[model samples]
Target: MMFMKSIFALAAFATAVYAQSVTIAAPVEGTSVTAGQNFTVDIARPNTLSPSQEVAVVIGLVSCSEAPFNGNCASFDVSQIFGTILYNGPYTPTLHNGPSPDFIDFYQNFTLTVPSWFTPGSASLNVAHVSLIGAGPFPDLEVKNITLNVVAA
Candidate 1:
């Protein structure tokens, strides 16, 4: 009976440790922008959640739809930005062990610096997807397919 009880306890603990999730809320669908301006993306935890959380975002640049049909679609260079946030409560310097409240907010901003030789037209800002790892007492999570459009200067 003692061994059986210990197995059950371990299972329950595993479930609790894998219950957290993260979400990306905005820059909204179909957002538009002009060159030389800043674009914003927002991240949050669902209202149904009740635990402190942490996440990192990576941003990248890709070719616009109007690129020549034969143009190297995969040739575009990629860049990354890093950010972290504490949700729905006061910020804590330490990871985990923070108080929980209603929602946690994070943002990623991208701006285009047009090269003097480039022409003015439309391009795409791809949010290379969100990755949630190292979650404590929470499920590992991910959000994908977020993107925006910009008109070159």
Candidate 2:
């Protein structure tokens, strides 16, 4: 029981330390996007002290049913996944004035050309952002999903 309590305390502390959030502002949820069309994905990480150069973003498409909610998918099936990585490298998020004079927001915007071979149906666009936390091996991550319909262009 003592060990469990200590573990809980550590988990809470970790959560508090890594409360940074990631937002996908483009391709609004539940909207329809055409395959083979180019669309911009606007990712924003506001008021974070994490270095933008140490942050990386990975964006891809997978079946809505296969999208991971809390953690990695229980079944690691890649058959349902499609589309090449839109962007997979360090991000130099744009700095902008924040709501308060002491804060600043970082925004990373990039264009992705949807694969023309995507089946016309519902799918989830997944964005995984990784930001290094201190010098630890474990990095802070945020995963977001936007469900949208894919139509043939």
Which 10 residues in a row give candidate 2 its minimum summed lDDT?
A: 69-78
Tens-place lDDT digits, model 1, residues 1-153: 999999997886555434333334455645665545545544433332334344444443333443441233333433332111112222112222214554333333333343333333333333333233333543343333333454565
Q: 137 in model 2: Cα distance from truth in Å?
A: 7.2
lDDT of 2: 0.68
Q: Alpha-carbon error at 46 in model 2, in Å?
A: 1.7
Shift of residue 128 alpha carbon in model 1, Å: 5.8
Best by lDDT: 2
Clashes of each: 4, 0
RMSD of each: 9.2, 5.6
**Clash count (model 2, backbone only):** 0
Could you give me the TM-score of model 2 versus the true structure? 0.68
